[model samples]
Target chain A: MDEQTALGLIGDRLAAAGDDCAVVDGQVITTDMLHERTDFPAGTTRYTAGWRAVGASLSDVAAMGATATAAVAVYAAPEFDGTELGAFLDGATAVCDAVGAEYVGGDLDGHDEFTVATTALGETDDPVRRSGAEPGDALCVTGSLGRTAAAIRLFDRGDIEAANELFRFTPRVAAGRALSPYASAMLDSSDGLARSVHQLVGASDCGAALTGPLPIDERVDEVAEDDADRRELGVFFGEDFELVCAIPEAELGPARDVTHCRLHRVGTVTESGVTHDGDPLPDRGYSH
Target chain B: MDEQTALGLIGDRLAAAGDDCAVVDGQVITTDMLHERTDFPAGTTRYTAGWRAVGASLSDVAAMGATATAAVAVYAAPEFDGTELGAFLDGATAVCDAVGAEYVGGDLDGHDEFTVATTALGETDDPVRRSGAEPGDALCVTGSLGRTAAAIRLFDRGDIEAANELFRFTPRVAAGRALSPYASAMLDSSDGLARSVHQLVGASDCGAALTGPLPIDERVDEVAEDDADRRELGVFFGEDFELVCAIPEAELGPARDVTHCRLHRVGTVTESGVTHDGDPLPDRGYSH
Candidate 1:
């Protein structure tokens, strides 16, 4: 069983499992857990771990187009390091400041391995959900994909500096707020564009058909080996914390004009099956 | 370099680190992470783990005298087991329901070992803080203490049934709500009575003096060997989720009258030092 199956036991009362955040009494709440072995690359700094762990969850808050408010973390490590923990808090505080949120406080415990679980809170007048797509809505994404995939490849190849620089993603908080008024359905592509599309389609009961060349990252082309197709890497290798949105055709112009984010018109939501390049989109994407 | 020292680096902007939950804009948020190896004794059930994890944080919420609204969990384990996961959710939902809160969904991931991080959200018109105690305030506790210590002993002796029964602690949600209006300073006795008093004193800039025999568990006496001092176990073993509060002497009767929870006035807040039976109290308790 995967996370989805385990959560299915919670029954239908819960909002579906794949949204950026859970809306509770008008508060947008989201959590992310970063296990050092799985989430932190070999050369990952404690600062980066804190920033990315908290940033990843803040990305969810941005996806909901809510005003970020507060965050708390749960830290578990067998042996505590004062300087490393200080760096981690600094990183967390920096990210929250960048995103207009507060790193309120958190809990700490001792465990065999280092792990950080962060929860972000946000407020919204009209909270967005991932299940509101219409047949003719424009499928849009906030930023370029494939950078994280390329960063991973770089890290694996010992290009630590380049990897760390490329991996630092700026959450589109301002753009999310601007688009919230217009977005019919929206989610963050933290799980890769392909899986995000699948999730959006599944949640909204609508399909998407992409048109023309995909927005492959420029860095992917420069760093990737021949085996790494930029498009495939962009689609399957996830951790792209960009907002994937479905906005009505009429509202797209306003959404574009109001936001400074690089908006990519990827496709259109359909009444039926999902397709990319006029072919059936493969059922593949990042899982964790 | 403990959690306290690490959090101290975050500085004074945050509410002090030792409180059960941090208050932000009238919202009380707290998190607790349970590592399977250290937290779950042998023969412990997944249901109990889930219940205890969420309940632990809820106890924090109760400590703040806030009305809990929601809870989210981050579950990480090497592999997913459907039955165990379901039981966990069952335990979580049961507690939320019992406390009049919603089990808002959560995140799940895979990790090397089993770990569950739970965050509980609450709202309060008059949120209680741990820094409000005044000299001459009565030092009170909700329910009895040393249950968890006794439970651990039972678990060590292979009495799983008694241990499990003892482990199911009821967070004083209703009682907290009632006491919020009267509590001068309040916190949960999660870090043992001794540590809690020390923390309350530290936060409130006051002291405490225990009047008599501690609220030792009757079960501790039943199961303990000759060397087992119930008072020491009660004051030092920790994990008692009872709320420890300081209410003015004039308000103690009203506070007790307003809540159904058993109120025990064990001591009084002093101007300086902490003591038990006219002797200086030891500065010791569970750290995590």
Candidate 2:
């Protein structure tokens, strides 16, 4: 079965399962796994792999507006080069440091291929959830999109340096925290803007009218073929790691001021179904 | 690098990494990953694999004298049969219910082979640690040992029923919690009794002189050829999922009363090295 089907089988066994992070008594817990062959390209370094793996889970915690605290990992491989493993640890530590979390110890095991499962712990008194959005709430997003899609294209074309630079991401922990008090609903867009909006609407039992322009990263213009490609990449490509939130229009100025990151007004929450440019936005995005 | 060396590289990143579970702010967190090739033999069922995987992490939490709260998983496979995935989820849920922990969501992805990583969260007010053992403390263990080793042999010999029965285990959550207030140090023997003692000593800055007979399970006598085979299996075979602890000699009776499990008085903590039968015990056990 696919992930979505498997998840359906799991069905409400855990109330925290659908949220970005499972908050238990104020502790925010999130986990993400990365497989070498699927998650990394041939040119991807072990350091970058480690960094990206840890960052992915931390981003989930950020989506809950939690303060990153500590993380543990399960690292599996057939055998690791000492230098490479060290570099991987260094990369993990660097990302944790960037988000004000500690890279705690993890388990190591032997496997035929490389895999990493990282779990991050965080804390928050007032956490955000995607189920709280109401009709008339403004749809907003933090930072830009399409950089990761652009990076993948570069990697495919053998532009390893540029790809590496673009692939590395900063988890929006600080900005998520800053927007928590005002956000009606929030989540991170690891599954592209289109999919993320669909998930948000599903959770909140509401809809969105995405009438504004896509938040296209300048990097997309440099790497993509044309305006159509840029728009498609911005809307459909995943791994953005940016917070998408529903908030009252009045809170927009404070969110921008507190986050110190450009807050784009993407749309407005409606009674039902998501639309962009007067057409239905598809509910598909990257999986696995 | 192998698992041990990679762990050595991790070295002192967190005070609790060396312990069975890391306790942060009264919350206990632990993770374990199982690869298909290394963890399961041919003919193993998907249900057993899932149960074993989730049980492994819960075992770590139990070793810390924590009450398991919830668990999350990272399941990866090249492709999954719908029936097999359902069975796996059933197994995972069964184990979680057995331990009174919620099977809260997980991440699923495609990979070259089947692998599972489980993380369990728990809570404890007075969690046990491996660094608290002191010289003159009594070294003790819960339940019998050598079952996993015996099970491996059974599987090798094509006795699948017997092997499955022997391989399944119950995490000592209640017993661990009962013993928490008294244990000087504690850890689970997932790496065999001998290696576990050595690790406890290494962490506590002391040694143990193992002077008693090995706690060989009754199944070992039924499965093994001789006394030497029993001893070797008990000491060398791992994945026992039993807790080992050090407590003051005077408190042994109270610990036994509290845990309600067979409290085996295997030895005493010393200034340095382990010995059995008046000879040095080898510092050898399962790795990876």
Candidate 3:
């Protein structure tokens, strides 16, 4: 039906030991998904491609509520020399450090172009998965969306604000950990709110309805070339690595309770097919 | 300096933990280096380019005494159908089956080319590393080399042999595990014998002497087009996932006694530097 659904079909055939040092270990979660391997060339500049590369895998571990311990990022390019290769390594090392992980070991090969993928190992007995959400739970977001998307728009144009806020986007680790104890069915909003909503509903086999206003920050509008720009940043664009956790209905005022990332109750999971204000919503939002 | 020595220079700055699950609990040994992210062309063939895309990484895992546990491979290409995409997946899955690993998770994206790079997870409580070899230890090898290099030479010219045993080469897993107890410094003849020999010495800080003749299997004649084929196969080749193990002098022949692989006593570790007899050997071989 969608990427995750399609992946679920395949993930069904594969199984490994419950314990692994990197991906199989309970401490870290692993994926060889489409998004995880693709390198956003834009990430090469502002935050640098290396950190984004390590961050790509670290974010997956973070989403699982695991604190990254070590990581091995494999980088491949056709003919990268000493200086260019050094920048890529530096980029990855910086992200590993900021995220509290270290580079242990990996391989390096020259290929057609740049593709850096990482396998991060983290530690935590408790992992926040994306299937624990209940139908009546209150939907809570851990951070703002549309920023990285905005950065993608302004990247080439040298828009300082978008590059400052978006390209250097950080995962809400503290907020994620804080919400891990109370929230359920946590998934990173990398694809978009629409696609993430599809994941929330599909994984739990439930539906969601968006009622309240979305958290489109003012900074998104500041970087917007037009009204469609802000809307695109808010809905369609991906790479936000923010967490969307389902909390109990009683703990609803997400903005007041959350500190590191702003939270908003944009929707509710339902027993029937999903809808936005009594209208059926799309079955999937993970864009191509 | 050798690759391992160069790696040590970079590995010096890395911070690591001692826990078994430190990187992924119970990891005894890891890979040499991870290639940077590589973008591939769209719709590559299942039995051709796609297989090599995954083989490169899996061979790295085989280089260590450890067995590959899991792999995460990704692809980024423009407008590939689900089936062509499935071929890439099939290639990766075949490697997993061959190596005793599973395809865990990976990423996918639509881009300019069909590039795939995989990170393989392997495990063994006591792995054979390059630093364990000592002077007076016998250098041994499993399987014949240069066929892969020869396969490339013929394949490039469209002189397809009925069966390319070299191109469809499987990593020597059973032999590696069987010899693990005796293997001091172990790795496959990946970059080439010349380079691998130098790698063993540089990392262990000992000299090596290539004394015996190369093990030229009958398969070489089957694939060779001319007499110069021996030279083509021996020097400058890539992708031979055969183990080159070092064992103590007392255990050398006996160690060779226990495998189906073509094990040969190729050389001995020394103190004067890597040499063919008493002459110093060069570290150049397969460039890729």
Segments of candidate 2 deviating more than 4 angstroms = B13-16
- Candidate 2 lDDT by residue in tens digits, A1-288: 777666555555556677888777787888788877777887878788888889999999999989999888887777967888877887888899999988876888887778899999899999899899999999999899998898888899999988887878888999888999999999999989999999899989999999968788988888888888887888888888999999988887777788868789899999999999779999987787
Error of 3 at B187 (Å): 2.1
Interface RMSD of each: 2.4, 2.0, 5.3
DockQ of each: 0.63, 0.63, 0.32
Local distance difference test scores for all models = 0.84, 0.85, 0.62
Ranking by lDDT: 2, 1, 3
TM-score of 2: 0.95
Best model per TM-score: 1
Q: Which stretches of candidate 1 lie above 4 Å from their native place?
A: A11-18, B11-18
- What is the C-alpha lDDT profile of model 1 across B1-288, one tens digit per residue? 876666555545454345678778888899889877878888778888878888999999999999989888987888888888878777887888889988777878899888899999999877787889999999999888889888988899999988987887878899999999999999998889898898889889989999886767788887667544677678888988999999999999999999897899989999989998789998788878
When summed lDDT is taken over every stretch of 10 residues in candidate 3 chain A, the lowest stretch is A14-23
Q: Could you tell me which 10 consecutive residues in candidate 2 chain B have the lowest summed lDDT? A: B8-17
Model 2: which residue pairs collide? A80-B1
Which of 2 and 3 is ahead in DockQ? 2
Error of 3 at B182 (Å): 1.9
For residues B5-96, write the lDDT of model 3, one tens digit per residue. Answer: 33444455453311111234445323222221322212225444445556666665665666767766565556556666666676667867
For model 1 the interface RMSD, in Å, equals 2.4
